[model samples]
Target: MATDQEPVLGIDLGTTNSACAVVRDGRASVVRRGDDRIIPSVVAAMSDGRWLVGTRAKKRRSVDPVNVIYSSKRLIGRRFGSAEVQEMRQRVPYRIVEGKNEAIMIEAGGKVVSAVEVAAHVLTYLRQMAEEALGRRVRRSVIAVPANFTDSQRSATRIAARLAGLDVIRVINEPTAAALAYGYIEDTDRVIAVYDFGGGTFDVTILQITRNVFEVLATSGEMFLGGDDIDEAILGLMVGAFEQQHGISLRDNPVALERLRAVAEQVKIQLSSQSGAAVHVEEVLPGQRSDLDFSLREADLRPYVDPIVRRTIPVCQDALRCAGLSPHQVDEIVLVGGTTRLPHVRSIVEETFGKKPQTSINPMSVVAVGAAIQGAALMGSLVPMADGGVSAPSAAASAVLLDVVPRSLGVHTLGGYVDFIIERNSAIPLEQTRFFTTTTDNQRFVRIQVCQGEDEVFENNLKLGELVLSGLRDAPRGEVTVAVTFEINADGLLEVRAMDKETGQQQVATMRVLGGLDDQEIEQMATRMASAGPGPSSRGGTVVSR
Candidate 1:
């Protein structure tokens, strides 16, 4: 058992909102600053050398669209030329470009910055708020990530935290975090499904809890679909209405469209709380306010957002089938994500699983709270395990987190087939080694392509990173036994190394990140921070507070 005095902080870094909490006296409570349980995950850089976050940063969106940053979570861990990146360009307001080493870049105030820096700015703000609330340096935390995030994506997230001055003890999958937050701590034997539909992403996970062990059976998700998609769908409806009413297409006008989109999002949120809300847009056309008296009954709103909800059904079926179970076998269903708050979401989920979904815990804050619980466990404040899986009697202890490979770990073979070394669902904090020979005579280099996903074809999977071993002496094609080891740490990210077995010589190596920041990009971000005036403390405006 850990000492009772220290607390473990749990953080939920979300696409639309972020929250933090700490476990004290065996009770978990969200750490609140003011009356907000959720701080809008928005950021703004003022011209006067100040930075603003949360509600204040959100205020700048209408007037200063060029300076405000929202929906940045989509860019993290993605390449500048990826399909997602191409789609984001047409959807979001900011400029998306290729930075050094194929890293995604965003332009603001005449400076180019990497996606990680933007994420760090938001995290740093959260850290400061938590430290101020706790009145001490909050050094340890358990952060949550989407269940389907890849190795490079997870690594980029950790790097963002490092830049934000946080020491993340571990990264828990969002659904698992929600399960922990829901008090799945008893030695109850049951299978539970977590339906996570957040702002920008959706994930469904099936877990089996036995003897206090939470084993995730299967996971599936759609990266581009979430509550945000619902908002976009409604925005399209609003735009169509405007175009029909007025002979002008608002889509061609960026500023007006951004404003209307923001309002459309608010209307969608309002529908969740109120049975009917008047959807109103300001000055959609100069001197003409676009006014549509919109009254949405629970029955009416269902059709518009139902398609979005329906997308999750197949994913759920896939997860259950992968776990070798039927819907009848699942004992409990839990909902996680802000979008789940919508009444239709629960009804559809219950109807699908034939069980009342657990709603005692707030979906939005569950992940963060669970992260704190895990954080406390890892900090030796909740459990006695060490960071490296040892035990300690006091504060020197750490918790052992045994995560699984969410997807198979593999390398590209000669004919484009993926050879799996350690398959998916294998116990983590583990290592796998493989040996190979040079393909051609006097081959001075051996190339390794690391990939994630289940597809046999290389193009169908997610290419995470690559490693190349060079400096081999002139020899026959099969002369050298190049031993390569791929190790996945507790964070579920990969690191690779290669060596010559015969000569015991370490080959020159480099991890070719499929979509990662390079030294040049990192330096440019540093310079941009110096030149872009002071960061705003918080942006200065308020919408009807969520």
Candidate 2:
């Protein structure tokens, strides 16, 4: 082992919960805070203006349903116009509004809060929990992001951590983090796939590992899919039951609907460990004391969620196709995420992959544990970096994180067409160069719109950023040659720049990122949330609301 000195923490911030682990004495251990390894990823504002996180915030949901913010992860780094935002608005009980600077805002306790600020509160809480568990002033950490998160999403996550006062050491993909955690157990030599189905994201990745060399062959995912979708299905069932019993629709009441959804989530968790679970719906209206309890069997639950589970199959097949492998060719299938705990989810994987997935490791903690291992390796405290700096920790100054461009990267071309430069799954920490020319004769400047996605039309794909190469001497169209380079680093975030290679002059252009909320806007909203505090008559029975 090479002697590198420093220590860092690893955090997996999830939609419903957050987990932290640290590498100590050559092993990774889940760091507990107040008797909980998995802290509820909810933040509530109390009447006194203090923020309550984790379990306390979760309890406050029953009383102060309006002020508690859960699952804000879906809104982070997203624009108001995105499909995910549109769908979330219809499904989630919380109010999401377009705020200043196009930031996504959540209405809580009579105050409108930005999604980033809510996330910052969660991050701040996790950081303190880790610090308390580790008994040190933790500053740097490794965070795990979904394999399919876009540039804006990753940037948003980084900003949230920065606001929380922690130095983000690195952002590793979730699948890769799980692979690192597995690789530490036994220096495995084979190709492995990490199938992650979380609360709000689904990612299937193929990785090759041999002699400390870990390479990601392919990755594919749907950002809107996950365990929460399954919960919604069960919630729909509860709604039907309530309608039949009371001869009234609960869906019309947002407060009652939100409470039912929360209880449905708990029932889903219980069903995973037991065969039958009962959910009691108390009188949701004023001066009501009657309760409606319904018991659901596992078989009854399977069909309701089969379609959602089936959606993951095609995504898995697509990932395998991208990796140029059939299901039989994969040596091992590793499961990640809390959703994988469901029996039906496991059965579907077994039927599709033709192999039993390894669940010896807790799917929920694997990502965070793996992240801690990588964090320790990065700090040079556990594993040593390699000399060539091209492979694992034993070989490089920077831990070689070979990430892939999840979607195609391109620039808008003539007639509204998009020309592709880098295809999806291209190894990261990678650089690709493409040449462009002035579209108009005697043009002194060229505008290039950088985009991500596989569509041929510019409008169909995501507009990531833009660049304009100016001050070029007037020349015939197609005469002035400009070289554009797209560089994606280990964190899977993009950086694009242009140069007149012929003149060796750098291009001075600003990038207009579509659907991104800036730091100033996020901070301003956070300040407002802090000042407004929580509302009265919203607290009761160990439930604290802010």
Candidate 3:
């Protein structure tokens, strides 16, 4: 068990990369090993039962396409048969399989590994990195996730942290964490928008900052829009050029596609600094004496990627509308995530917010720094940092975070419609209850269909699972009134409780979240990971330059 005396680490477990930070003596700084501040969220298996993580693992993608797993975050906490997973299947070279409860499992390293387990590998590597940098053992941490993450995704992230041997003290939204990192909390009230564009997801959040209180007013996002999509666009051009030259399509070749994907990412990164990037792939056609070469300038890429960048505009408009604010009302715009480094992306953000984005703090590490501030705040050691941030804060501390639910939570009702119990954007740690009566005479039980969405028709909304209220008092129809309460805690995890209205006694109430690992399975994977081997090769490897 971790005690309050232990230092808490703040982690940004991202889709393409991961970073960690901590607060010491009122200053929060991102922890780094030498010049490396962030590690690639990739893992690979060696033939000797050893696992390679981070940059080394990322480099293995071209040679070991099926065994090297990246972008697992998109599938984490998702069903294997979901549209998103199915869509991802077409892009990546790895194998996606269905696990128990339809949870997504990736076949890598000659064995099937759950997304949670793969994420745990990244978390474990991050933990080791933090411990090495801080020169101490830390077990408590605050994690940041995307604003659009559902109950299952958040739960799966927590389990990953548990497997990493760290106790999760809190989970904050990425955009919210970025806002805190900018130290936007001043005496006067101001509205700020966080445009977080990363490798595998994009999110836009509008928040109102008053003194030390950060309240999220509205948020909108797309899970599949980011740098990866841009890479895909570049890959498309490469595939077309290859087909034109060699009269062959590399689209169906996993190895060729993986190799092209790597070069495409490198080209994207290179074009950010240079006028044009030269992409060359040697021996692209198996053992043949063949090469695929190309050159791309920013202007050439703008056509293919501008559409992807513009997709975020409507999402921003939606968030601002939901927040009851206009573009002019926003006092400042803060950019977070690696994808924000692109000039085109920056230009788009400026056009949307009518202001230059904040660039003093590193976009890649800001969220982690803010999360560390929150962790220190929770431990009661928080102070206003030198940069744009307050320490990790406790709920009871002077610095408070007012987060909201991303979607509407409701129950199935008459006419197969949805009865929204808690509307979207409502503040957290709040509870709402609705009374239910039996429909049949001598009814002993009632099953409440719990869902999350704003659809008027029940079937159109997402089915989270059901809450059963049994052992009811046998009475005539409508005589027995059962009070069902839905409570969303600070973590945004749903909890249901039922009570007998007549007897004033608590009854059975449990919510079964779909497309996630159960408690026992989480424990089993944790144990298995413990014995998996020494995680993250200590041998030095090249770190990608951002």
Candidate 4:
């Protein structure tokens, strides 16, 4: 369906697996690599100094436990000292070291690589696969992210796309994208709830769709919860069973643990379709002569997983409350992410909504399909459907999306109180300005301590970064008024600008995101990637060129 023009791709850069899709002839479908539609988001460093991506990389995890790096999504755009990164370091087999600017880095392939770089490799593989499937060059794309992603995380995702040589036209939220895929072409206007429980993160979003406009009323979720937790629960059960059988704990052995993790994931999938699954491992323990076999019934695993699935209920209820709507007010409940395939997950969702959730679309590919529709709509290439709505709209007509900021943004004052600039759930692509003056007489500069949270106490919130507005006129405390502007862009990334009221001059301030790479570092990595070209074994014998 693509002509000479380069096609735009919609990529779901997920934690457990990633996918891509495109729009053709007013319909959206997923792009596949040979017979495979989902690619594992794993990367491995070969002994020959080459990198392996996707399935090949995932296979190397058990063999080269120290070199294969998966779940880099959890580390991307995270501070080295943050609680999340510290937790990840303890769980993963690869080594995580602090890099410049306190960014999280991993030791792989005899080199120190930032989480951004590792993620870039996965993005590159997806880009190549899309191009090959379309039989044309693919550059522009719309990438999806969690609804609760912070400014640094959003910025880091954009940078990763750039490193992969893709021009990201927009970064849409995952739940919003799912809604678009589900109701974009429906003729009726209604309120829909999107429950996106993915591999690495979970997000619940409430949206009101009217004609061609989709407005996100409220969004909330746990950044650390998802299908990964289910896998972890099963892994723990296996670990206990193995230890009891062999009288030895395999937790200390990274290689054996990795092997068991793979089996646990498979069993988790099998249990979804069947009442029980048999998990068998041969030579699982060190120097073991016998095999370990165990029967895992759906009922036995439900105790561990049901509690985790129930955790999502409060988040969903909170989101509905934020939207000022009750559960019955919601017309349709759409499920997204692979974890939604679980029978218990669906049952709980139905009970919560008093309605059956829609699962006609493949949960794993819905987000990407929705993103492709958005991309096509943005590019003015979508053709209007025969119905009142559009399966795909023309270039002259595009749907309007109104998103909101997930958290409140403010600055720390002299009294250690937060001066709220932008409130949470405020419609995004918004700008607000507030004026502040120095507290001390003849103060030469003022410090702006930016933070993100609802806490009134400055220290209780997460510190985003700081800015020092210098070269101010040495006037009385209240006389030197400065106007500070806080802007949340369409992609939900924050930007601040300060100006002197009297001189009308923009103040020079340092804007450093706490867990993000600096311009210089990004540029250096771009240069290195360009010079190195594609890794020798990156494609697992599938030819890829720079």
Model 4 C-alpha lDDT per residue in residues 14-83, reported as the tens digit of each score: 8878999998766788999788888889988877766788988998988988899988988888789998
lDDT of 1 by residue, 1-546 (tens): 554445666888888889988877556788877787788888766665455678878878877877777778888998777888899888776677887677887876555567888887777667767776767777677778877788878888887887666788788888778877776656567888999888888889998866555667898888788888888877787777777777568788767766776787787778777776676555666677655433446567789889889988899999999999999999888888889988888888987898889998888898888888787666554443656554442321232445678888889997999998778888788899899798799999988888899899876898877788889888998999888988888888887878898998987777889788766656655555434332332332211110
lDDT of 3 at 396: 28
TM-score of each: 0.85, 0.82, 0.86, 0.87
RMSD of 2: 5.2
TM-score of 1: 0.85
Q: After superposition, how far is residue 252 of candidate 4 from its true place, in Å?
A: 6.9
Local accuracy by lDDT, each model: 0.77, 0.77, 0.84, 0.83
Worst 10 residues of 2 by lDDT: 534-543
Badly placed stretches (over 4 Å) of model 1 are: 1-7, 45-51, 210-213, 232-267, 274-296, 381-401, 440-442, 519-546
lDDT of 1 at 455: 95
lDDT of 3 by residue, 309-372 (tens): 9999999999999899989999989988888878899999999888998988888899999899
Q: Residue 97 in model 4: shift from native, Å? A: 2.3
Give the per-residue lDDT of model 2 (tens digit) for 1-546. Answer: 443334567889888788888877567888786678887789886765556778888888877866778888888888777888888888766688987556688876666667777777777777777777766777788988876677888888887887676688889877778877776334556888898888877889887765555566778888789888888999899888877777778777867776787788888888877889987666756577546677798889999989999999999999899889999988888899889999899999998899999888889899899888888777763442366443343432234444567778898988999998888777777889898888799998877898888899998987786777778877788888888888887787888788887787888655666666655676775565444332111221222223
User: Who is ahead in TM-score, 2 or 3?
Assistant: 3
